[model samples]
Every structure is written in structure tokens, then in C-alpha cells.
Target: MERVIGGSDRSAVGGRVPACPGPQAPGQGAVARSVTVRLDRRSLRGWHIRLLDQLGQRPDRRVRIAWVTQGSGLPGNAEVLFRLEAAIHGLPRPGLATAAEPVALAPYEARPDETVQTGDDIILDVSGAPAAPAAAPVWRLDFDGVPGEAGLLAALFARRAPVAALRGPDGAPVAVGRLGAESHTVMLAAFEDYLARTITLIAAALDGAGSPTLPDGAEAPLQPGRTFDLDGFGAGRRAAGGLARQVARRLYALCFQGPQWRVGWRQVVGPDLIDLRRHPEGGWNDLPDDGRRFYADPFAIARDGAVTLFVEEFDYRRGKGVISAVGFEAGGPRGRPEPVLELETHLSYPFVFEADGQAWMIPESHASGTIDLYRATAFPRGWVHEAVLVDGVVASDATLLQHNGRWWLFATVRTGGGSYSDTLHLWHAPHFRGPWTPHRRNPVLIDVGSARAAGPVVARGGALIRPVQDCRGGYGAALGLARILRLDEEGYAQRVETRLGPGAAWPGSRLHMLSAAGGLEFIDGSRPARPRLLR
Candidate 1:
């Protein structure tokens, strides 16, 4: 076979890299090691990658590899890996064993980041550290629901995972993309998914290649459930110092990864049979509540009215995710609940309550990517989607509560471009109608501990209580009981005195929560009664 050297030829070529005898792994606080480069085509770098895999994280997976390059603002800005004997100067003058050649002269698999364009050439002048080489200093501030939560905000949204350098399930490393501020919400979520999916990939890669096992990345303190000390991280600011900035930088460097991140899971309850007497259509269809093909978030209230449960009924099967209500008073109910508010598609987070002699509702309207409130025009049977309190939300499951003469709203944000099911964001308004202002500390609350919204119900004791989903164990497997100590401009602070019973609700390894309910009410929502065929 003619040795198809480097350049823009999309062909399969193979070679091997020599070995390195330096540091073996990149631990939480460890230094990176250099690998031996061999071969002739930019393929040598490819070879170097393969060599590193044999020296992988665990014996079973390929070693994760990342190239560090000084960033360029221009179009083709990235380090181009090439063959040892490839060209350096003007254009390529290919020789058997020449001085060097640019990877731009290489085949697809032999080149780095597969999308390199033709006009793009290698610039070898600069060198920098790979992502895993960065550091993450501890953050002590807890944005207890105030504004300008710089320290905590920076830390919470910091791209702090070493995902690109981690081996995938097949012993291959993740392809790293450009790194900088994740300015948009979509980028943030994409980043989070990247990190998480990379980990899974590494795990699968390792399994496939008969390599050693890696620790579950999602379960670590440095990952999905990352912890920050509340001392350095509160709603109020401490002294502004270079130290804070340094910590932020270190975190960005040390823990940042391709997938931006957050956290999930708690004690998930079932798709209990909601007496659909409200949806008098009768057998329009029957659905289960076991949480099979659907899940829901509901609030039960008894006003001058009857016991009504407002829920966001999600039909993963029908894909027609909608919002509806079901009512069942203690007297053993008469008829099945019916669907009241129906939409074409995309509606969730059906949080219902009565205020000022009127009923109000908020459901997850992710399609519009905004928050909307509805008014019950005709008791429990009819609702009109009236107002949009907030728009451009990259978050879900919003909660609005009237507190201390002012109205406070809580919602989980997918910060650092990670999972929508992770990270928490807060906001408030003087009135429920909301000329709503983002809590100065927008994501005033965080912690995979309760990053996502479980429920923000108030307690009978007068002090506020929030049921937090403890995703540490897994989604909805456990719950945390948090007491809202303060929610004023002074900054919101919370004391999670206890974690609600881990195995108290469902007999599984997960949990899910929606909205804040008042005094001793059974949370209700749409759930499937039987197991789902999750294809």
C-alpha cells in the first residue's frame, strides 16, 4: 500500500506511536504528562493518540487525549497536528523523510477536529495547556437569592470538566471544540450534554476495547453533583479581591470540559390514576401513572372550591405533552377527571393556585422558551393562556409564590450550557403579575443538591420550606428538606436541615418533583400505571 501521507485526502491510514513513561493519570489536582510522538504523516499525532490509549485511564479504555493550542479569533484558528517530516514553510514539497509536513496535508482520520477546511493551514508557533491542566478553587459564596452574585455565578456556570481528555467507552477521547465563554443558553446546554455524553462514551469505549474501568464521571463531586462551600458563596458579597477571580480562573482551568454541566434525579413517584372525571370525554384514552411513558407535576388545593389537582401531564408516548387538571375530594370521588386546557403541543409545569379570588396557572411552555400564566376563565373546566411573566427561559418548572408582601419566583436553570434538569435560577417581583426582576443573584440558588426544582411549597409554621430533589443518589431517589431563612434583597439563604427519606416514596432509584404546594397536600400529576417500552 502506498503510504498515503498527510494532507487533504480522505483515506484510511494506520500507524503506531511509541510509549511515554511519565505520570499515568490526570487526577483532581494532578499535572499533565507528555507523550512520545512518532511516525511521518500528521498521522503520527493520530499515532500518538493511539499510543496514549494503550496507556489509558483504566486498563480497559483508551487514554483520553487533548491538544493544547493558543486560541485564534480568525476563521481557521486551532492547532493543526501534522507528520514529523511534513512541510513547514510555504506549500508542501513532499519527500520520503523530510523535515516536517502540515496536517492540512493529511487524511480525515489522521487530522485533528475532522471539520478542518482546505484553506486552513497549521500554525506551529504557539503552545498551551490542555483543558484538564486547569484548576478549580473552592467557592464559598452561596447566592442566597440576592443580585450580583458574581463569585457564585461565575463558579456555578464555569466550564469545569475534563471531559475532552477523558476516554470514552470505546477507548477513544472526546473531540474538543473551541473553549471560551458559553454566551448562549443553547451552547450551555450543548456543552453540558457534551461533557455528560463524553463520559458515557468513554465508559462505553473502555468497555468495548477491553480496557480498564473509569469512575462514573456523573456521580463525582467534581461533576453533576459538584459541591461549593456556602461560606464563600452566599447571597451577599464579601470583599472584592484578586483571590476570588483567581479561584474562578483556576476552576475554569482545572475542571472545565466540553459538555457544560449540572445535576439530576430524586425520589420519583408514580403515574398515579388521577380521577379524570374532569376530562368527561371518558375513554378518549386511558393512561397509567407509574411514570412509564409520562410524568407530571401537580398541586392540590381546596379553596371555596373542591379539591383540585393541577398537573402537567407528559405523554412521552403520544409526544403530545399537555397540561390538564383532575379533582378528587376525600369522599371517594364520583367521575373520572377530564382534560380541560388542551394545546396542540409542548406544555408542561402545570402549577395551579388561587390568588385574589381568582385561579392562576403556570405550565412549562418550552416551545416558546418562555414562562406563561393562565387564568381559569370557567372554574376548573376552562383556562385561558393569558400572560407571559418572563420570556427567553433556558430553564423549566417555574414556581411563583406570594411572600412577605413581595412575590418571589423560583426556577431551575441549565447554566454553563448543561442539562435543563440541573442548576437553579431565581427571580422575584413586587406583584404576581411580574414586572419580574431576576434575583440580583439570578441563579441565587445552586447545588446538584437541589439544582433542579423539586418543589417550593411553604410550610404551616410560617417560615418557607422547599422540597429539593437530592439527585446525588440518582434522579428522584431521595429528597432534601430545606428551610428558606431569607428571601429579601439581603440575599436568599437556605438551611437543608435534612434530606427527605430516600426510599420513602417510590421503590426505585429515582425521583421527580414539580411546584411548591401548601400545608400537607399530596403532590399529584399524570403518571403511567405500568412499565413503559422505552425504545
Candidate 2:
């Protein structure tokens, strides 16, 4: 629900990225051509107008708008539910001032004198459709594999499907994304995030040189089985529960942190999680934490004799996180985690490792708008700032791996206005510290279920395995292991081979972040816990 894409306004992270121009063919007369976008005047919302504004601002491509005045609008209860939830939660109310006003479309609508015509080279239909006829190749914006406003309504009201995508006229997928609602209790926030992602997907598809394909055996297209009722039955039923749900949530927040994450670890033998593809027979041992705080994003390193574990220690009273470390011997943890690195800005995912005979850390500093390197000047404590690997972008959980004589930096970027856990961006450099170059296709992948970095990329068998956070259920709801098949200057690719979630072994509602070192494996998951006062 953050202000993502508006008229040339900057995002929380940085400046607005211009829309991608429609791809041009390779020929003597090669140049990006105009595309016709058909929209429903009746259902026109702020997002539709935003999308059109983006397309019109395409640097090299022109846009023609076609109005569908006869198109059906969303369920009446849709806006009602959004307003109800916003009022109770005190959520960000973007465009609420003119929520009831009709959008003026005359400025954007194609005039009769325009050179481009509908049903020409390509028709990008966003309206509830009898899609444009076969005369032109059509790229239809869909939600849960159903086109237009109805598709979004079906997912929000009927199926409540977490996954969404864009499909071509032939039903082949152009881009697929998981809805990123850290909690699904609020429907409007999730839909707004989805709309932001819609903009990113459409832009990428338009500008990408070659056809984009989902990873082999990845998320299959979701079918919203029965068409959603436009009569508002589902939306009406959901709205009726709003008051009760809001009251219950308020009571819950009074006593406990919405989600208190914890770390779990256990000694391993020959094969680790990357090898076994399942949890070990003996369940994990809890890494203890005081009731006043929670620990998460575990990473480990083997030193001369013992293993040191690093984590993000978040204090309830302070409401900020800092890097903490603990040492482990044969029996258990040396003691409680001690603060190792505290900064003015929030930090997490203490990505620690050894190189050049010195310990180093790259704690996620996305909130500061920089990815920094810190050298342990005095072993575990006395850390000193070393270098800034990348800046000017909000990058999360930056995991680094040296492969094929290159250092590959992987992290999910908060591009435009979508979930910070969905779009995967890559940067590489000859050394770990300097001169990083972004991949030609910067956002190599956009998958909410398996895009964010969970932990380090390690080698297994003859292949490289990367740990990714599966955020479809929500951010850090699950963990996944992906096989890095191709990664180089030209392109990047990966296949999610396995996904693990909380169960009897983990005993939590969320499981995310995986790491292993010195015959010890580490993981983290969410557990509900009341505040110290309540306890």
C-alpha cells in the first residue's frame, strides 16, 4: 500500500523508473511502434490512469487509448471492503480524497485525429474482454489467469488466490507473480501491491528482447475455476465480517508482537539440508532468546575451533534491529547472543563469511539505501566500515557467491511499487568489494514465491544451489532451494527444486532463511509470543 507508481513521483526507495517501451523488431525500419490499450471507462480507477500515464511516457513508444464504455465494473462491495479495512486499520489512504470522483479520461483518450488505430499491430487489453480479434497479437493483463477487472475481483472476493499473472491472447503466460500480503487480513493492501507488480510485469514484457518464460516446472498458471459473480455475492459476504475482524485484531495487538520470529539450529553429519532435501530426523534445537526480544536471519561461520552464529536481534522497546553473534561448541550455544554491530539505521541478515584471512559482514542495510561491507577489526566485535558495494537502491538480504571467477551479488530489489520480496536483481564484480556491474536484464526474475535471498548460495553435487525465501503465503512464510542452471553476463536462470515450510519439526507458522557451517545447520521461523509485561 506504499506510494509506488504515481505521476512522476518518487518511490520510497528512489526516483520513478520510466515505463519500458514496446520491443522493436530487428530490420532496416526497426523502431518501437505504438500499441493500443483498451480500458473500461466504467471501471476506471487510479491504477488504470496510472498505467496509461506510464505507457504514454514510454521513451520510444507511443500509446493509443481505446475506451470501452460498455464494459462491466468491479463488484460494488469491493470499494466498500477497502474503505472499511482502511478506516479500522488506519492504513495508508492513497487517492481517498477523490475516491468517489470520476477520472477525467479525455486528456489520455485517443482522439479521432490520432495516427494510430485500434486492432493494429498489438492490442493490450485491460478491460473485461472479448479480447481483440486475431487481427493483432494481443497481450491481455490478467489476474489469476482471468483477464481484466473481473479477474482481480475474482481473486479478491471469490478464490482468494495468492498467485496472479499476465497472459497472452493464446493463453501463454507473459509474467507470473505471487500476491505479497505479509498478512492477508487486509485485501485492499494486497491488491494495491498486485497492481504495482502488474505495472512492472507489463513494462518488462514490453521491453524484453526475447520471449520471457517461467522457470522449467515452476508455478503453473492458476485457473479461477468458476467465473466470479459480478452480482457482488462474494464481496458482500466478506464485507459483513469486517467489523468483527477489526475488533479482534485490535485486541491481539495490545498484548503481543504480531509475529515474533525465532532461530533454530542443530548439528549435522555428512549431508546438510542442501543435500538431504528434507528436515533431519532429530528436530532442531531452539536458539533461546529473552521475551523482550526476538532473533532471526541466521548465518554461521566456522572459526579455528568453534562455530559462530550471527543473527538479527530485534528489541521490542527499541523497535530497531542490530547484528548479534554467538559462539557454539560441541554441546550448545556458548551463551545468549551479544550485540556485535549496532547502527543508526536498521540492519538484518548478517551475511558473514571469511576471506583474505579476515572476517567480514554484509548486513542488509536496505533501509539506509546502501549495501555496505564491514570488516571485523577485532574478531567478532570491533567491526569497522569497509566498503559500499552498491547504493541508491533498496536491496534486501544481499547474498554473495563467487562463481566462475566472478562474484555474483543476489538480492530482491524493491522496484517501482511492489513487494520488496518479489523482484530478483543481480550484480556482479571481479572482486567482492568493487566495480560491480548490473546484469543486462537487471531484474533477472520476478517471482514472489522464490525471488528473495534467504541465505548463501552453496555448491552441492555438480550444481550450485541457492536458498530463496518463498513469500507467496507471505514474506518469509516458507523457504525454497533453487538450482542455478545459468548465470552469466548474457542471462540468468534458476529452477526451484524444493520448498520447505513450518510443520511439526519447525513448529511455527512461518519458516524462512537457511544456513549451514561447521557441521551445524541454522533456520528461522515465526512464533507468537506475548510481551514481557504480559508474560
* 1-535: candidate 1 lDDT, tens digit per residue: 1111222221223643333334333222222222111122221212122223333343211212223232111111001101101111122211111112222222212333333222221111111111121221110101111111122223333434322232222223222221123332222233333323333433332233212223443211122333322222222233123324433332233222211111111221322112111111211111234332233555666666466665565432243456666655443223533567777645666777778799888877654547788899887867887788887665577777787788877887642233455566777888889898887776676676766566646554567767677765544445566778878866978877656432323222333553322221343221222232232
lDDT of 2 by residue, 19-135 (tens): 334444311123224566666544566676566667666545656566554454454335545543553455655432112112234444434444333335556667654543445
Cα-based lDDT for every prediction: 0.40, 0.68
Runs with alpha carbons beyond 4 Å of true place in candidate 1 = 1-295, 331-334, 501-506, 514-520, 524-535
At residue 144, candidate 2 shows an lDDT of 53
Q: Alpha-carbon error at 291 in model 2, in Å?
A: 1.0
**Clashing residue pairs, candidate 2?**
none
